[model samples]
Target: MSQALAHNIIAEADYLATEERASVRHELVGGEMHAMAGASERHNRIAGNIFFHLRAATRSKTCRAFMADMKLRLGQGALFYYPDAMLVCDPTDDHPHYKQAPCFIAEVLSPATAKIDVREKWSSYQTLPGLRYYLLVDAERLWAKCYSTNATGQWFEQELSAEDRLEIDCGDAHITLTLNDIYEDTGLLL
Candidate 1:
């Protein structure tokens, strides 16, 4: 079972309203709101590495990369989540509070959210038509899991070791994230 913060049931509207004023972030699951915990230094470093490389890669393009602040509306608003990192190439996905379409999503695995990120989110994110790559980044290791969608819209899992490179091809937008880039600044990268 996945652990949730606060462990309370809240309506979607109520959660949204409170989340704006709340200091910390929260994710809505099945109409229930769970407060998001602060990440470790290593986790933030890993996420920041990916975000920095992605931001630079898409700087001149129409796409934008966000680091854990943008909300993703999943299951047609049935679930609201904050992915660790995301890239949206479509202008329509530029919503104020939440985003509907994302070309790529990254989740840095932690003990508390790994199961939910890998299992629940895995199933939920596939529903988006624009999503092409979903990356599961390991904080304690150098490996990552890349799940890519095919032309038929079927998702396949690919393992990325330290020797592998990440090639993200979105609609007219592309970015290549290497393991060293994703783990930059960490001793592992050197």
Candidate 2:
């Protein structure tokens, strides 16, 4: 789902201010605009499953779990990214676009966008000051990998497998996950 930026129909700033609530979502990258692709049934299911677990796990905490449709306004240095799922622990979750610093974010990868998720998207998400964990899920393989920021602020990767139950430690709240749970009904190749 990659497309060349159509001739600059609107300036990045103007695009931001206008149609902020438009039905068709567009992402800004170095001023180039690319419309988002519609989700497939598998895509929707994976996102739904993750959010469901996150919501229940964080109910008593200050963190809020959200589905992919929520816009994330990554600040100046990066573009606005709409992750497949996100968790925000910052008290500023009231902001429009869910611009508040999020503690965790996940992207369900499709073959068309896997590189972007593993590279560009991963790089952009890491820039968020308050971010702690980043997870990448492979739709075709049903594989999951996570990156957690260490005490010195550097991020480290952790790989999760079907045999092992995974838990994301988020201070007061922890999100327990198993790869099999997300792909239960997907009938994924792997």
Candidate 3:
């Protein structure tokens, strides 16, 4: 979801410290804090569905799935974002508060954050060398867009509806997700 900038700019360490104790989550962009807003019911369901499938697929594997609370640090700690769902496989990429390497990231798009998710977040996420797949799901409908990198490092975009399935390559394994799975229990028609 889109965020509103908080007060004055603060140091990266200060922001992290504040986040540790603050009840509300915030994203730091270039040392400025942006308070994140709460998500809607449909958005929560979609994100939960993504996390559920990802967690199930990665169970007993080296990779681990994380949901909204985990922070994704980018631009060398100059930026921090909370992705809806993400999969991280690199053991060395771990940090207590944030993760640097995520092979797959999914965001449930709301009207308030669709532009940022498609433009700003997509641009930033593509810069990560470890990132291979980015999925944007529409909260109001059974529609999703996926961008996956091929063996040659070329990114390809695919649009999926209710009948289509999303295939993700996780290096050690490949997982397939259907719109029926993503939109499950959300009351969205396929």
User: Using Cα atoms with residue i matched to residue i, what is each candidate's TM-score against the true structure?
Assistant: 0.91, 0.86, 0.93
Backbone collision tally, model 3 = 0
**Cα lDDT, all candidates:** 0.87, 0.78, 0.90
Candidate 2 local lDDT, 1-190, one digit each (tens): 9987656655656767654767887777766667888877888888888888889988888888888777677756236777898888777667765455888888999888889999998888877888888888887776889898877998888888768676777647788888877676777733
Question: Order the candidates by lDDT, highest first — what do you get?
Answer: 3, 1, 2
Clashes of 1: 0
Question: Compared to the true structure, candidate 2 yields what TM-score?
Answer: 0.86
Off by over 4 Å in 1: 1-9
Clashing pairs in 1: none
Instruction: Give the per-residue lDDT of model 3 (tens digit) for 45-99.
Output: 9999999988888888889899999999999888999999999999887688899
TM-score of 1: 0.91
1-190: candidate 1 lDDT, tens digit per residue: 9986775667777878998899999888887778899998889999998888778888788888888988998876779999999998898776799988899999999888899999999889988988999999888777789999889988889898767778998766678887888888877674
lDDT of 3 at 22: 97
Q: Which regions of candidate 2 deviate over 4 angstroms?
A: 1-13
Error of 3 at 183 (Å): 0.3
